[model samples]
Target chain A: MLEKNKLYTIWVYLQAEPLFWLTLTIGAFLVGDYLYKKSKLNPLVNPVAISILLVASILIATGISYERYFNGAKFIHFMLGPATVALAIPIYKQIHLIKKETTSIFISLIAGSLFAIFSTYFFAKLMKLDIEIIYSMMPRSVTAPIAMGISELIGGVPSLTAIITILTGIVGASFGTFALDILRVKDMTARGFAFGLASHGIGTARAMSRNETAGIFAALALGLSGVATSIIIPLLFKLINF
Target chain B: MLKSIFIIFLFQLIGESIQKYFELTIPGPVIGLILLLISLILTKSTKNIFITKTKEEITTTSNFIIGYLSLLFVPIGVGVVMHLSYLENNYIEVLGVIFFSTVLTIGFTALLMEIINNQFKKHARKK
Candidate 1:
């Protein structure tokens, strides 16, 4: 009975600790990455998306709450802040490219950012989504942290905005290549900026993996659009009395 | 690795402080990033030997971190699970808007930029 009880205690301890879920998150990501590579880097089969599915399902199967899973995972979350600051490295390296194309880049940033905001708002209303949902979706194109702040300021739910922003990123990263090709977007800078502006970090990741120039431009635009949208979206809303 | 990471954290700290001081909605890390970039550029142009060496260190460390950037996002990405109930309740509209809008936004931005860039090239050639 003592030996049998020892096995049960070990299982309970595994369920209760952060280390198990942390390992599980990393393991799931490795599996997802392997599958992504095996699939020839198919965008549709995104590693992050796959890992999320695997980890979430495992949590569900084990009857673990999302809160507890996050407790183990928050260490990784904390790193995103520093990583964001580190983006300056790539942007600095590509400063020349940014300076050379300042005119077109600024134009593209304004047009694309406005298009993203207005289209999302119009469509959400067209779909008859709740007003709160509309507000949450407004900043979906921005980086996660910035988007969450924008959502809160607009009286939307921050958590919902975060999920929507991530979903937008995954969608953009996954389908971006195909869309760029279909649109005949030949300029690497344009391609990179588009993905970065619309999809933020994940899209930047995809761009970086494709080529160096693409990654640099993506980083530039990712940072630019975040700053631009943070200021512009709020002003636009206030001006319209929204 | 430790030094590079510390440098990044220091920038992030400075960024956060400025953000709070100005009551800006923009994140501190981003502002810190721009400050870092400007400082790096200034240091590079001045050709400071010590600064150049540190820049190289930052470059190598930043590159390594970039490689794992996606990994850093995994935890937040997984938070999607917490919103499953809300998503389930509005699957069609939510998913539809996300899918179509993402496709449209990417297409429009890329195409518009490409068109503008080609025109600029054409104008430069004419000059």
Candidate 2:
């Protein structure tokens, strides 16, 4: 009984330890990465998904509130801002390859960004989904960080925005090439741009695996469309008053 | 690497300040991105040795940060999973909407892009 009591004390101490939760977050990712490799790098076996599940399960089992867990994990979350700003470096590197097509590229991407926003908006409304869900679905065509920000501003549930954004990435990555093939759009650059603009990082990953040109264009679209969507959605919201 | 990171943070700070004052709807980091891009462009041909060293550091540090980006989202990803029940009723609708819109957006962008590029090339030839 004395040994059991000592063990409980250690567990309680660890629960509140910021380093413990931080280590657990990283440790969960390591385990998730191992499983991802074991699964042959399958898309559905997403490391982020697996790690989120692992930590969420542990949190639930331990009955720890998310606020406490986040207290420890906030260090990791805080990097997102610096990392997002760092995005400009890569986009700058790719500037020369895209210099000639800059005009066309920018126009196509803006069209795609607006299309992504409004198409989801109208479809969700047509289905009679809740307005919050509609707003959530609207910004999901971008990456999670940007999408969640838009979700917050436009009255969407940020959590739902994150989940649905991942769904869009998975869907676009899985079927993006097939859909493009069907559309007779054989230009790899265009296809890559479509993948990034519509699906965000996951589709960008898929495009990267295909070839170099496709990968570059995919990356270009990912950052530019994110920036464009950020400006466009709010402006549109102000205009539409919804 | 540390200096590169500080530079990134510096731009983010500038961005946050400007965004707050202007009441911009854009994310501060995104605004920082534009500022960084413009700065990189402005310094593209500079002869300053210090600027040269900083540029290389920025590249490697930013790439390192980007490589582990998915790891950083783990917390929010976990938060979203907890709230899955809130979206449970609209799963089909959400999935359906995502599929069609993604497919449509891809097709529209690809087709229109090709057409615009071809037209641009022909116009250049005519000129």
Candidate 3:
């Protein structure tokens, strides 16, 4: 009986330790990665998506607040900055292709950025959602940090914006390839750009898994679209006074 | 691997400095990306010392980083739990807008890019 009590006390202490959630995150990703690999790289088996579902479920079941989980998980989040900077290497490698299509890339960036923002706004408005919801939805297609930044600047809820951005990523990462195929957008560069523009980092990851050229274009589009949207969304919002 | 990581973080730091100095709306890492690209281009053109080896190291290191890029986002994705009630209350609009707008954005962006790309190719051939 004493041993059982000691064990339980240790368990409770461990649960509150940041090391615990950190280990859980890495372990969950390992499992998710294993399943993803076993499934032959199916988009449906996306490791991030699976890991999120697993982590969220565990948090809910254990009654641990999301903040507690993030205490450890934030370490992983910090890596995103470096990872994003690393993307420049891939883009640099594909500079020739990007140079060749600079004009088209610019055009696509503008069109895609505006279309994503407006379509999100229009849809939210049509649904009669609140103005704040529309504002948060406006930056859904950009990466989370930029999206959240833009959402906050535009008077929206950053957490909600982050969630919406994740959902956009899941949707784009899952359905993007199929949609591109149906539309006969067979050029890998175009397909990758579309995916990244609509889904950001997650979509870029999906594209990176497929081909190097696709990954480069996806990164280019992802980086540029974020920059473009950050500048454009704020200006447009201020102009419209929304 | 360590060298590559140092280079990446250095660029990120530089980028953060520039972003803060300029008060730009874009993230620091993105600005770092641009700076890194420009430096890479300069290195390639100027025949700088150790350029080949540096490029090779960066390429190999970045490849590994990019391979598991999606995994880094898992933490943020899990942030969904922080806003469960908001999502639940607005589930209909949330899911519907995400589904419709994401699909529309993807389809529209791809179609437009294809059109523009074809036009560029045709114009380049003429030129």
Candidate 4:
């Protein structure tokens, strides 16, 4: 029975190894992405959220602590910084489109960013969420990395902000089109800017898939709105003493 | 691909340095983003190695990174489990707030943008 014992030993070793969790992280992402594709890229089947559930459930099932999981998963997390830096390329490419509608694009961007912040704040307040939860929720309208960063600065749990941000993205991507249609917004640019500003990357992805002009404007606003929110939310919090 | 990765990471490092040096509140990656955007704008004419990357090279690398951007967030997103205690009692309200705010934000932004664009068009016609 040495062979059986060897298998058990290997399993035990795998559990302790950081690479196991890393592999799980990538594998889970693949599975999630596959399902997202199968769903025809349904916004509800968000790859990131699915991957998160897959990993979190596995972690809980295995009784492995988050710290241990993070020990392995941090490699993927580390890529976030560089990926964020890479947003400049898309933003740069979209700059040409912005030149024609500069006034309209800039105005909607500021208005949307402000609405994202204040609406979240007042709604969370109305819902009686904790101050910390409110803080984490403030940047939910922006991309995940910057949202997490903003959450950290505001003394909120960055991790929670990540989840909240993902949830917000799914919500935006899923309902955004329907909402825009209801508003009778025919302009692709407006529709795109709305998705990018309110929904962040997920909405931008949806916008891109649906229409080219919408996609371009969506991407442009995705970067601009993130920059806008990152600068505004923290200072706004201090002024509101929140 | 390796070169692309290097350029992206290099910009990120430069971004971090500038943020740290200036004691900037903005994240370094973001600063890196702005700097890279500026660099791309200025270096439309590339001549040498350090700044030699053509737009195609930088765009290829950045696009590669952006392609897998969502995957990078998976690790941190899963950390939401630790906050399970907070949600145990009030998940509905929290989710309600999130959904409502998101819907409101999207609705208002789209509506406002449509109105503003119409106004701009009207002003242009007047001109």
Query: Candidate 3, after superposition: displacement of residue A46 in Å?
Result: 2.3
What tens digits encode model 3's per-residue C-alpha lDDT throughout B1-127?
Answer: 6777889899999999999998877899999989999988888765556767777888898888788798888887887755668765788888899988888888888888888888878887999
Please, what is the whole-model Cα lDDT of each candidate in the order they appear?
A: 0.86, 0.83, 0.87, 0.81
- Tens digits of per-residue lDDT for model 4, A74-129: 99889888877787887777777678688888888898899888888898899898
The most accurate candidate by lDDT is 3
Tens digits of lDDT, candidate 3, A124-190? 9899998888888899999988999999998999988988998899889887877887888877888
CAPRI band of model 3? medium
Better of 2 and 4 by lDDT: 2
Against the true two-chain complex, what DockQ does each candidate achieve? 0.78, 0.60, 0.79, 0.64
> Model 2: which docking level applies?
medium
lDDT of each residue in B1-127, candidate 4, tens digit only: 6777887899899989997898765678878888888988887667766665456777887777677767886777677655566565668877898888888888898888889889988998999
TM-score of predicted chain B versus true chain B for each candidate: 0.93, 0.87, 0.88, 0.80
Restricting to chain A, the TM-score for each candidate equals: 0.94, 0.79, 0.94, 0.81
Q: Between the candidate structures 1 and 2, which one is better when assessed by DockQ?
A: 1
**Candidate 3: which pairs clash?**
none
Best by DockQ: 3
Q: Give the runs in model 2 whose Cα sits over 4 Å from its true position.
A: A35-41, A144-163, A166-188, A201-219, A234-242, B110-127
